[model samples]
Target: MFFHQDASFEQLSIHRVGNKAQDEFYVLSEQPVPFADDEVLPGLLMQYFMSPFAKVNEVYRFMHPNEDLELNEVYHFTKKFFDGKMDFHSLSEQLAKHLYEVSSHPKIKGGELYVVHLKNVQMEGDSQEAIGIFKSENKETYLKVYPEQGGFQLDYEPEAININKLDKGCIIIKNEEEEGYQVLVVDQTNKSQEAIYWKDEFLKIKIRNDEFNQTGNYLKVVKNFVNEKLEESFEMEKADKIDLLNRSMNYFKEKETFDQEEFEEEVLGNPQAISLFKDYKSNFEDDFDAKFEASFDIADKAVKKMESAYKTVLKLDKNFHIYIHGKREYLEKGYDEEKGRNYYKLYFENES
Candidate 1:
């Protein structure tokens, strides 16, 4: 199938390889994609299809929660989608109609959702056409989103609010020539902002995708390396390990790059410890078949994204995440007589 939009809806915009245009998106198939997990697959109302873009490059787009669906749910959603009663476009309209009903935010005058089930889309590169789908909510006007609390809410010349930056959107790219697709999702509503009730409107489901649940594999491995290997190898205590991890982060922040010797000195603060680190780094990488960076450059974006993983935690049986950071003096570990439990007491001053 090709080139479909409601005849009444003239607002459907297409970005493709035209003579005058540099950016382009082409829909190769009018058919719904059969998707998979680990392999890509689509969810209900949200079908899974592959787009050619996934092969050419990996872009960091905020994915929807459901984009990374497991096999069963994927089949369920796709089955509901392709049940043969409603076509892709009809399903899209049904979704759009529901969203319009629930958007009661006085300022957010609602908007239209453009759901085009596409396969094989391409950009300017030499890569072949890819299969995927697009479901984007387009607004007639920008919603007044920002609040007066942050700063002077001054009237300035308006620029087109980036849809992906502010509202809900999703793009799924089919994997290579295969039927599976990778997804990119975006949901930009602020915490304090009044709800648009997209869920109440249609598709009562929370999105779950690998993109949103990214463990930052490399950095995660680094963290595990510290926790599993180095923590035990050096006979370091939990506090020591936490401190070392904190110091390593700072070293990277100040130096902007990680060097083994400096990390040893600043974090371990002893020659013997440094030697142990060196040995472990070498052996661990060799065993894992991964290259240990002599100097690992820390990107600002990565630091921002991965900062929370580095925090020290005292897990208390689902009660709280007692986050501890800073010098050890502020924390006191002791035994509780009545409770028959060991406890970590944190001392702090309320400067405010």
Candidate 2:
């Protein structure tokens, strides 16, 4: 069973594939049997066939409320009119006959299924041509070619109007294939393609009207982008913390490379006076320069602490040379695109 459009007439389309179209129809119903709490075969078959028919009847009535149907009478009769322990073929023949009689009335032809019996049809004098028998799975039976076959498969059908916009109420079917085609209705018209926009003239609208205001879909997309970036930033921050501590240690070690006595005396004047400095220098010389080495070590640790903090905030690597010889410098940022360990030069330096 498929939902398709007909421009010329109002009709339902049902196609049976291969030998067991009857068998296949019943089996399709078997899937829904558990819901009805019926025995697998008979109960399943009854529910399967009737449910879609009922829905179609309801839709037909809604579309044509003025028309009276013998649908209810047929439904009641068919429910109890089953043959004893009917099989798929038997039930199908019975249902087909019953429907034909009930819908034979002119006014209620809407629900009628016209069976075109073209058994063993062939050209008048062409026995050797032999186009009559259609091959079924197990056996080859005479073909039933109806005049309606020309109309059954359309060669060039008119294209449906394109709607340029899609609203929130619009149904979206992803990866919809050709044979199992699914269409959406953004407005009153059917949307069969991907490019149709609801705002377009194909929707047969003059002024653009929002169908359930689908602008929320775009807003959701923006929200997702922000959330993803936030997550990435959080991860980068974690990686940066380790970088900071490493840089802090490197900074102080670089600072220690400078002469401590000169840094203290010349850079920072000894106000407690030159006598204290002289005594300190003498104490350092006595113990094989222990005081000088210890002072450098302490300076190195302090500089390392500051450098670590910067590295954390800036996301710099440990191998990246950051020097503070009166000025900050960046030696590397880690791997290059090609060579893997290329260094980068500083972009700028302050004149001050």
Looking at candidate 1, what is the lDDT of residue 166? Answer: 32
What's the lDDT for all of these models?
0.44, 0.27
- Candidate 2: clashing residue pairs, number: 15
Model 2: what TM-score?
0.14
TM-score (all chains, Cα) for each model:
0.38, 0.14
Q: Write the per-residue lDDT of candidate 1 for residues 1-352, one digit (tens) a residue.
A: 1111211111122221111122222322233233333232132222212221223222322123454432323223433454455455444444343444444455442332445444433432322222222333333344454558776454443433332333554443333212233434344452435433433223333222122122233355456667877755467667666766776666555665656666666677778656655676677556643455555565555555667888687676677676556677787778999999877877778755
Write model 2 residue lDDT over 128-153, tens digit each, in one string: 11000010112222333345645553
Superposition-based RMSD of candidate 1 using all C-alpha atoms, in angstroms: 16.6
Quote the positional error of residue 182 for candidate 1 in Å: 17
- Highest-scoring model, lDDT: 1
Off by over 4 Å in 2: 1-84, 110-352
